[model samples]
Every structure is written in C-alpha cells, then in structure tokens.
Target: MMKTRVCACQTKDVYLPERARVVASEPMTATERFLAFELESGRPLGHQPGQFVEVSVPGVGEAPISISSSPTRGAAFEMVVRKVGNVSRAMHELKPGDPVGIRGPFGTSFPVGGAMKGQDVLFVCGGIGLVPVRSAIQYVLDHRKDYGHATILFGTRTPAERLFVAEAAEWARAPRATYMETVDRGDGQWTGSVGVITTLLPKVTIQPAKTVAVICGPPIMYKFVILELRRMGLSDDRMYVSLERHMKCGVGKCGHCQINGLYVCQDGPVFRFADVAQIREAI
Candidate 1:
C-alpha cells in the first residue's frame, strides 16, 4: 500500500502546502514550453492516470495541470505545460533549480486497475490532451501482459502542435500497441491522416462491451469525441474524460474552482461521462 502523509501549514503560506523541487526541465516544443519539477519530501504521487496537481510559484499563484508521467514508472513525476497564461508564462521563465509549490495528485483518475484489466483500451487525445492520457498509456504499456490490446488515436491542430512526437513514433512500433495520428491540416511532408479526432475513431476496431474509452482534449473536442465513442458502442459508464478549469485552491474549501456543485480542483478534473453529463458547463 502507498503511504499518505498529512501536513499542516500556517495561514500566511500561499503555497500549496507541499513544496516540490525542480529536478529536470526540458522543452518539448519551441514555444518556450518546458516541464521541470520533482517531489521534495512526500512519497511519490500515487495517483491513477488522468489526475492533476496544483502547482504554485509562491507569489505568482497556482494552476492545475495534469500529471503526465505514469505512477508505475517510479521515477520523478512530470507535468507538461505550455506558456499560454499568466502562471504558465511565469513558469516557463523558471530554470531547473527553482522551487515550486505542489499540492495533489488530486481528483479522480482513469479507471485502470480492475475495470481495465482485461479490456481493450482506446485513448483519444488532441493537442495537449496527450499529457494526461500519456500517464495511462504508459501504465498500460509497462504492464502489457496484464491487459488486452491497446490503441491510441491522436489528432492535433497541426504537425507542429504535436506534443510527444518521439514517444508517439516509438509506441506506434510497439507490438501490442497500435498508434495512429491525424492533424487538422498538414504540411507537404506530413503523411498521416488529416481530419478531426473523431475521424480516426472509425479506423479502429472497438469491442464495446469489453473496452473502455478514455478521452482528453480541448473543450470543443470533448463533446464530439464522446459522441463518436458512443457511436462506436462504448457506453457512457465506460467512457471517461478529464476536464480543465481555472483553479485557485487544491483543496475543495475554496469556491474559486467549483463547477456547479463539483469542485474541479478536488472532486475532479477527471470524471465519468455519466457523472458529468447532467452538470451544465462540464464539457
């Protein structure tokens, strides 16, 4: 079993109550993007795939980003971030030695152990959505003998926006894993399929009753992907998705991150399709 530790912090500390160190940082893209940080004191973030962490830069505030590394790896945890907003812009400027506050491995994660044990898994991702789904894919790949076949169908706005090119190429070559990709529009050198993420769904074989579908993508991508998954015969309960929202506190006490009654910060950034379907603005 994993050990869970609880710590108390004073009121003046604006950090996430857990401080992680910057172990390694590298840019996966040319847009000033990089991933840097490691847990300092706590046990490894024992979380399922599709969960996120609340990272803070002291006075700079916090942002919730999905944990990109798999727990099964037992290496340093990782988060992939783009330099888009305030906190992310600030985060991009930091070097490898800087300190950042982290609180969580929070929220529900993809159902991987029991539910996915003997089932075929289909991962549909777009743009940065690959970050969260990467964890689960890595987990499944690591324990390939424990699960059924796995297929990954990914689409990005363009080839330049592809998140994990090298890894994606490697997974494509793996035995039990079939990797396929598409871009909305491609330059001349691109040879992969070109279309929305939904377009790739029909290319794969999905055994609905024996498969689970996990999707992560932009707001506009989720509904369409879910619709496609349903058309493929995957039930709502068998479909899972991770959501992104502005979050202030990692815990549920703060009202800043509430999506209706659900706290996106604590309750989930990941939810079953059935659980979030009734909640307006959840997509």
Candidate 2:
C-alpha cells in the first residue's frame, strides 16, 4: 500500500495582519459584498487560487475570505465576503479607498500547474462555493492553451442570488469552455435550468479518467456531488474539495479549524478527496 504524504507547512506569526487599501467594493447580494484590495506597498497578495486570506476590520475583528480573483489576472486580489456576523458586517461597510488589515494567503491550493496541464477540469461550485472556485476558473481561462476541456457548474437558490453574474455569461459563451448554471428554485424572471447543482452533472461531457473535479459548497452538497462523480468513475484522488471553517487563527495554533488531527486552515481549505475520505469528520 502506498502511504499518503501530507505537505509540510512552515509556521510563523501568521496572525500579523498587513495593511491593505480597498480599491473597489461592490455589493454582490444583500448579504455579500465584492471587495478588491491591494497591499499598502502595492505588493501582490501572491495567493494561489483556492487559498484564503484573513481580512480585518480594525477593532471589529478578522475573518477568513477566499481569494476570488486569480493571480493571473493582476496585482490585486479579490474576495467575496458574506455578511454573516459582526466582522463581516464591518467588512460590508468598507468602501473604496478604505483601509483594512489582511493576514495570509494561507492553505493548500488547487493544482493547476504541471500536473493539471492538458487534463479535463470540472469545477462544481454551489452558492458561495463559487466565490473561491472563481479564482481557479479564471486561471484556467487565462491560460486556456495549457489545459484540455474545462467546465464550470454553478448552482444557487435563485437567479437573483448568483455571484459573478456578468462573468458567468461570458464564460458560458467562451470557446473550449462549458458553463452550466441552475437554481434550486426559479422565479418568474428565471428561464434557465432549475434543480439542485448535482443535476447539472449529467449535462457535462467529461472523460472521467482524464478529468480533475474541484467541488465546494455547503457540506451537505459535497456528499451528493461526490456520489455522482463516483458514478461517473472518477476516483477519490481525482476529486478535490474545499472545506472552510472558523479558522480563528490563520496559523495552526487555534484548534478551531481542526477535523480530528488535521488542521483545515493549514493542511487545507482545499484537499484531495482521497486524503480526506478516511477522516471520519470529513465529508
């Protein structure tokens, strides 16, 4: 039997937040805000797609936000923050030119490098899961020549609740890309497919043996999606899932993000299903 090897993470005072300036802020939904920020000195956040950064609102506190924009895009990074609590509420109140604190570009990232070149890629994002998957999708789109066929599946509760409304349309029409979107429930104005995100899987044309599936969403969504992927003959090693938690500290010190013995904040916010499947706490 082959042993599973976990990546080593170097620890430091990863809690120290860097000063950043909000260059743009737009409301994506009633509870979510789209924010673009750059470091004080204009240094790139240097984060890979699927990694997360801690954004602080002065005394209000800090919260982990997935880097939504791909580094291949530009110097600045973006985050789609949902206003679920006090810290997020403060983040939503931020405007262009406002100052904020940022710590880390932490956690494991989706492998879009050499290993993924020329391979079919399928991204399954549910609701807010699209926030992080957007980065990976953009990276592939920008370097389209380096990969094989690429597909993106997005599911939300309604048309009004969708994120990246404009980009989603563009991707749907882009060459070599397959973009499908569905809503669990539709409104009078909604005309697209209506069903759970997993249902969209049947519409995708993928070579299971050559595809790498990246799945993220509410925990419950993972099970159904994985079941479908398995039915398609994809192995656990070929599938990756992002598991976000209350990582109180970006460094592994705070046990808040631990599942059994592994720290989700350090070992992953992104993990290959094969490694996570054995852990009882992991979905």
Q: lDDT of model 1 at residue 174?
A: 74
Candidate 1 whole-model C-alpha lDDT, 0 to 1? 0.82
TM-score of each: 0.90, 0.94
Give the distance in Å from residue 61's predicted Cα in candidate 2 to where it truly belongs: 0.3
Clash pairs, model 1 backbone: none
lDDT of 2 by residue, 201-231 (tens): 9888778789999999988999999999999
Residue 260 in model 1: lDDT: 90
lDDT of 2: 0.90
Q: For candidate 2, what is the TM-score? A: 0.94
Give one digit per residue, the lDDT tens place, for model 1 in 8-112: 554445443577877777777766365746777747877778788888887887788788888987747877888887788878777787888887778888888
Error at 97, model 1, angstroms: 2.0
In candidate 2 the C-alpha lDDT for residue 33 amounts to 94
Q: Count the backbone clashes (under 3 Å) in each candidate.
A: 0, 0
Which regions of candidate 2 are displaced past 4 Å? Answer: 1-12
Candidate 1 residue runs with Cα over 4 Å from true position: 1-16
